[model samples]
Target: FYSELLHIIGLVETKVGGKRLIERNSEGQRHSGTILEDTIIHLDSLDKISRLSKAFIYGETHEERLFNVALGLNITWINRILFLKLLEAQLITYHKGDKSYAFLNLNRIREYDDLNRLFFQVLAVKHEIRNDDVKKLFEKVPYLNSSLFEPTEIEHQTLFISNLKDEKTIPALSNTVLKDEQGKKRTGSLSTLAYLFEFLNAYDFSSEGSEAIQEENKTLINASVLGLIFEKINGYKDGSFFTPGMITMYMCRETLRKTVVQKFNDLKGWSCVEFDELYNKIEDKKEANEIVNSIKICDPAVGSGHFLVSALNELIAIKSDLKILQDKDGKLLKFYDVEVENDEMIVTDEEGHLFEYNPK
Candidate 1:
C-alpha cells in the first residue's frame, strides 16, 4: 500500500510539475483545479501520503479502493521514468522490466531501532545525555566526512566532541548490549554505528525559509515535535516536555525588545509593533547593531538549545536587516562585513557567530 501510494504521488507530481493531487471532500467529490489554482492546497504532503496509504489499507469497499487507485492513474505521464528516479532517490529499489519495487535500505530501519535501544541504555546508565552531548557525539563520529556542514562549524563541533569527558565511551556505546522487545540480548554492531552516523548527517535541524522568523520558528516546532514523539515512544511519564518554539521566540523577542527600548529610549510606539518593524524605525544603524550585539541571552533549561539557538538567529537577523538598511542609504556599519560566495551571502559579524549558514 505504501509503495503504491509513493508511485501514485510520484506520478501525479511529475504530471503536474511537482504538485500533489488534490484530495476528495467528505461527500466523495474529488477536488478540482491545479494545486496552485485551488482555493486551498494541502501543505502536509506527508499526511496526504499517509491518508492515501490508509485508504487502500482499510477502505470500506472495493469501489473506495478503486477510487484511490484511479486517482493515481489519472495523470498523463510524459516522463515515464520519473517515478523510478524518485524511487531511487528515496533509497527504494525499482525493477524497470518487471515493474517490481522494494525498499533498498532495510538496514536504515534497523539503524533507527538500534538508536532507540541505545538511547534507553544510555538513559539507564547516565540518567540522560544532554542534547548538546548527543550533538557532540555526532560531531566526533568520523563517518560524516561529507561536506554537509561548513568547515569551521564542523571543526568546532569536532573539537567540542573531542573535549567531552565521556568521549572515550563512544566505541563502547556501539558495543553495548541490551535486551530487545522480546527480552533477547542485543548488541549494536559496527553497521549500526555506520547507519546512526548516516542518519545524523541526513537529518537537518536548520531553517530553510526566506523569512527568518517564520523559518526559525518552523524549525523549532519541527524539533520540538520530534522530541515529543520520542518522549511518547519511550513512555516518559515525568511530565517533562519541550518548550514550544513560538513561546521561546516570543520570550526572547520581548526580552530583547524591552532591553532595546529601555536603553535607546529614542524609539517610540515599540509596545505595539513587531521586532522587525521596531528595528527598521531606528535611524542609528550603528547603535542598533550595537544594541543587538550587547544583549546577552541565556536559557537555563536549554533543552536542545532551542531558545539560545533561536535567540542567536534572531540577533543575526536583526544585524543583517540593519546592515541592509545601512547599505541602501549609503552608510557604513562598523560591526559586520558581508561576503558573497557562490551566490550566497556570508555575514561575518562580532566575535562569536552562532551556527553556519549553508543555503540550499
Candidate 2:
C-alpha cells in the first residue's frame, strides 16, 4: 500500500497527530531510534516512501527555520513575493499546519479570481495551475461577482449543495412561508420564473422604461435575463465561462450607473433631502415597527447570496420609501404599498398564463 493509504489505515502510522518521528544515526553509521515503542530496526532502503519510512520523515518544518534557510534575501524574497501576490488577491487563508508551516489552497484561490481564466489555465497546464496563480487571480474579483460566477450550473450547484448538505437552503419565500411561525420549517420551491416576476411587475411590463424590451417580446426579455443568470451559474456551450466578477460588477455598475447611482446623485442638495424626507413622511410611521417589518431578501444560488439578495434588499428599501410617501398622502392603506411578503399572483383580466410549482 502507499504511504498515505497505510497511514490512513493505521497499518504503520506516519504523522502522529501532525508530528513525525525523529531518527538519527548513533555514530553516523547506523539507525539509532526504535520504529515503535519497543521495536528497533536497521535501515535497509534509504529512499523508500513507506508509511514506516514516512514516520521518520517530517513534513515542511517551522517557518523560522524555513526563513533561516531563505535568508540573505534570496529564496525568502521569492517566497515573500509569492505570498504578497496571494495577499493582494486575498487568496491566502489559514492552512492546516503549524503557523511556521502553513498550508494554502491554491485551487480554491484560482477558482475565486476568474473561474473561466483559471479553468483555461488549469486545462492548459494539465488541470493544475501554480498555487500563486490561483491566489493572485481571485483577489482581483469582487466578492459578489466572484460568488455569482459558477463555471457550470450543475458542477457549481453540486459544489454548493455539497457545502450545504446539512444546512437548510432557501430561495425566496412564499406567502405561506412568510406567515409561518418563527423557528418553524418554512418550505417553498425555487423557480426560474420567479426571476422575471418582480422585474416584469416593477415596470408594469410596459415599453416606456425598458424600451430595449418590447411588450410582445416579454418572453424573450425574460429568457435573456434568466438565461444570463443561468449561464453565470453554469457555463455557455463549448465550456466557456462567465467574465471575472470584478469586471462583471464594473460593467453592471457602468451600464446601470445613470439609472441607479447617478440618478440618486442628481437628486442632490436640500431638494433631494426634502424629497427623501417627504418620501418618508408616514403619519403613523413607528420606527420600531418599520424596522421589524423590514423586507426580506433571498438568492437561489445564495453562494453567499450576493446579486439576488442585494437587488432584493435595494428594491425593498425603495419600496419602503415609497410606502412612506403613500402614507403621508393618505394612501397608507397597507403598511407598505406592496406586500411582497404576501405577494399572491391573481390572474386578472388576462388568460392562458397559469401558475405552476417549480423547484429550481
Candidate 3:
C-alpha cells in the first residue's frame, strides 16, 4: 500500500518537476517513457526493493536507529559533519557573498574537492537547505576527520577544482534523482528500485562460507536495530555478562598497575632456573614459550570471542605502552626478553634457536 503511494507520489512529483517517466530492461538497459517495460524480474520482487528504498528515502525511524547501533553512526550527524567540512572549504569565498555548499544536496557529490562550490550551491538552494543552519553546524566542530573521511586528492584543492569544472549541469536534476553516465537526468519508474532489489536479494540469504553466521544457532537479524536487540538477547550487549562494568574497570586498573609497577615484588630475590635451563629438559620451544610468557584465561560463556577480543586489545595496549617506554628510555624494558619485528615476536630458545610467534 505504502509502496503504491510512493509510486503515485513519485509520479506526481515528476509531473510537478516537468519530467516524463521511463522503462528499463535486463542486460542492464534503460529507456525513457510513461509505460514500464516488463523484463525477467517481476513486479513482486521489485516491490521488495521499493520497500527498502523507502527505508533510505523516507529515512525510516527503525532504519535510522539501526544505522546508529550497528554502524555507530547517525546519518544526520554524518551529513552535518560533511556539511561543516564543506563550509570550511567555502569560507574563503564567504566574504564575497559567493555561496556554494554541495553536501546539503542529499544527493551524491562526486567532486569532493569542490566542497566549497558544493556548499555555495547547496546554500543557494533555499528550499533544500538553509544557510543559517549550515553556519551553525560550521561553528561547532564536534568531531575530527577519521580514516573513513580523511581528505584525498579529489578532496583537496588542485584535483577538486579540476573535477568540479568537469561536472555537467542538467535540468530538473533535483526531482530527477537517477542519472546516466553522461549526466543525462533520468525520468521513469526509478531504476534504483530494481538495483536495490537485486542488492537486497543477494544479501538476504546466509552464506555457508560466512563463519560468523554458521557458528551462531539463531537466525540473523536483517536490520540493525533488530540485530542490536538480538545481540543483547544473545549475550553480546554491553559485554557485561562476561565482565561487568565495575569488574572490567577494576581489572583494567589492576592490569595497568601490574604493567607499571611489576607485581612480582615478593619474588625479587627468588630466581627460578632460567627459561633456557628449565626448557632444556623440555621437548620443544613452543612448549617452553607457552610456559614462560603466555597466560590463557577462558570466559565462562565464550560467545563470539568477546572476552578474548577485549583481552587481546588490553594485551596489545600494554605492549604498546611498554614499547613507548623503551623508546623513551633508550633501553629494553622488563617485557623485552622477546623482540617484536614486523609484528612477529621472536624469542631466543635454550639452544639459541629463534622461535617466532607470528599472530596472523
Between candidates 1 and 3, name the one with more favorable lDDT.
Answer: 1
Deviation from native of the Cα of residue 61 in model 3, angstroms: 37
Q: Roughly what TM-score does model 1 have, to 2 decimal places?
A: 0.31
Global lDDT scores for all candidate models: 0.36, 0.28, 0.31
Clashes of each: 0, 5, 13
For all predicted structures, in order, the TM-scores are 0.31, 0.19, 0.21
> Candidate 1: misplaced stretches above 4 Å?
1-191, 194-238, 266-283, 320-360
lDDT of 1 by residue, 1-360 (tens): 112122222211121343323333333322222211121122122133234434555246644444333332222110111222232322211122222222113332233332332222222233234355343332212121222222233223112111112111111122223334675543442332232233222322233222344321221213344433332212222334555657766776667656655555544334533445565567766666665566666767554455676566555555655463255454765566543222223465576352233423
- Please give the ranking of all candidate structures by lDDT, highest first, separated by commas: 1, 3, 2
Write the residue-wise lDDT of candidate 2 on 1-360 in tens digits. Answer: 112111111122223444432222223322111111001111112211132222222234432222222121111222222223233222211221123221123333222223234333332243233456644544332232222223443222112111211112123323221222564533543221221122222221112112243433333222123323333322211222333334434443333322333344343322333324534433444542243234343444433223443344334444444453234444533432321211111121123343222323
Q: After superposition, how far is residue 92 of candidate 3 from its true place, in Å?
A: 35
Error of 3 at 358 (Å): 18
User: Candidate 3 residues 1-360, lDDT tens each?
Assistant: 112212311222122133322111222332221112121112222332233433353225643322222222112122333334334333422333223322222233333333443334333344334455444443322233333334332123111222222222212223433355675654444332232222122221222112333332433222222222223323322332233323443464355335323322222332333322222243443333323234455767654343444454454344433332233434434343443332223344445454333322
Clashing pairs in 2: 63-100, 89-139, 113-138, 152-234, 153-234
Alpha-carbon lDDT of model 2: 0.28
Say which candidate scores most in TM-score. Answer: 1
